[model samples]
Target: MHSYGQFCGLAKGLDVIGDRWTLLIVRELLIRGPCRYTDLCTGLPGIPTNLLADRLRDMEREGLVRREMTPAPTPAAVYALTPRGEALETVIAALGRWAAPLLANPHKDDVFLPHWLVLPARLYLIDRSPRQAPVRVEVRDGDHRVTLEAARGRVSARVGPAEKPDTVIIGQTPIAWQLLLGKIDLAQARKAGLEIQGKTTALKRFGVRPPTKAVFISP
Candidate 1:
């Protein structure tokens, strides 16, 4: 790891995680939990095999990652984050929040993986109607799909179709994100080619309210 040669906390933290694909490796581990080497490769397309091995080794050496063997029958090695590594969740989450605006103007060649939506879903979705019963909102983008279930004042997201979705949203992933962020209403989303079915009220439960104006008091 290359050091910034500074004694500051930020510089010290960067010294451990600032290498190319380091944080992304952390992201995969955070999203998928303990994963086989092959699983990591699958999530991170276009990464070279040797480079991944090298990064994992560096992470292990830095005490940020550890490898463990699963129980017999079909035993395999999996990589997981150490407690120290898990602490980076806030840093990764903050970066995700910071990048939300950039999604609006994606480059033509950008790769849109549906699984990446999980982070934003957790970040943005909140159960406005927490007192009400649970609601399942299924989102689809081509073959990729994810379900957002709101219940008991918390919203949880998972990949795959909901068994019995209360509301279904079919459209481009980006458009769905815009809707979830409350940047566009249902009517505008329909005009943009999204199809909404079932209880429209289900979505409102995960409401994103407009920021309230601050009152200025006279001095």
Candidate 2:
């Protein structure tokens, strides 16, 4: 029962997805495509189950999502965007562009390594370039392992064991983030005693360039 009243078209659009969590939920679907409830919950940590369920129901009623029962004997459901919902991708992408500056500020001590980078690195593809296929990567620290694949301007990551890749990047989360962001050079990180194992060529391949100028935002 959400209504825009006399708001402008853009304001009316926001009325449908203006809530904080709603836009984020749409962002995930737009980026990753169809997903199960569990997957959505995993990507969006800290969301309460009851609230997520309510949002899903609301979105469905609003024509932004479509749900289908899977063919499993016990039957599970998955959700995907409808055409109207899919149109939101452009808006979400614009929001990301606007937020990029805030994302680049290095002074924020609250910055934490995005879980997207770690965890199930084994099942993912990491691509630093939009033009190149994702270089395969395998990450291991103790019993944890994650694999990555990148191709066609997309990256996919999964968790599990596998053969070591050409490079093995080892560092605490903060240093890792800095390295990834180009705030710290690989040589500097190595001199600081961060472990960089595996093939030297692989190390070079995995070295991601930091953005020239970051959009500064408070975390």
* TM-scores for the candidates: 0.83, 0.63
Model 1 regions more than 4 Å off: 187-191, 209-219
The TM-score between candidate 1 and the true structure equals 0.83
Model 2 gets an lDDT of: 0.60
Tens digit per residue, CA lDDT, model 2, 175-205: 5445544567778878755687665443333
Model 1 residue 138 lDDT score: 93
Per-residue lDDT for 116-202 in model 1, tens only? 667667666778888899999999988888888899988888777898999999988777777776768999999988999999988
Q: Clashes in each model (backbone N, CA, C under 3 Å)?
A: 0, 22
Clashing pairs for predicted structure model 1, backbone only? none
Give me the candidate number with maximum lDDT. 1
Window of ten residues with lowest summed lDDT in model 1: 210-219
